[model samples]
Target: MPVFVKKVLAWGSLAFLIYFMAFRPEGAAQMFKAIGAALMMMAQGLGDFLTSLMT
Candidate 1:
């Protein structure tokens, strides 16, 4: 995909997610919880990988 198209799609998806999270908090709580867990996992994995590289 072209860079602009990709950026637009990404931003659109983010906007939708934020919209629901803001206005439909009860309905979107599970999804937000999952996103939070995934982000935390990603951070921990990246930290471990970087530590290994430095050692």
Candidate 2:
């Protein structure tokens, strides 16, 4: 991607995160928790798949 587009996306994401954190701290926490859970699940699934392939 172009530098301009990258900067725009970075700034936009930062602004959105700040807004979410300031205006809805609880919601932001919950969202982060959900994201963590999803990532954990994905990791576990990948591990299981790798184990199955080896066995």
Candidate 3:
């Protein structure tokens, strides 16, 4: 079903991320950390947006 497909895609994405982090970790480490920080910021922004919309 669609839910199974979504789970597969999510797991695939996670595997790719782990592979990238493991190999060529020098420059990639900083890049991945920066991306993780950006994602966290975006998540926080989304949460704030949703909270504001509710109130």
TM-scores of all predicted structures: 0.54, 0.88, 0.53
Worst 10 residues of 2 by lDDT: 7-16
- Candidate 1, 1-55: lDDT as tens digits: 8999999999999999899989999879987788899999999999999999999
lDDT of 3 at 10: 97
TM-score (C-alpha, index-matched) for candidate 1: 0.54
lDDT of each prediction vs. the true structure? Answer: 0.94, 1.00, 0.91
Ranking by lDDT: 2, 1, 3
Task: Return the number of clashes found in candidate 2.
Answer: 0
Report clashes for each candidate as comma-separated counts. 0, 0, 0
Candidate 3, residue 52: the lDDT equals 100
Worst 10 contiguous positions by lDDT, candidate 3: 20-29
Ordered by TM-score, highest first, the candidates read 2, 1, 3
Off by over 4 Å in 2: none
RMSD of each: 3.6, 1.0, 4.8
What is candidate 3's lDDT per residue for 1-55, written digit by digit as tens? 6999999999999998888878868867889789999999999999999999999
lDDT of 3: 0.91
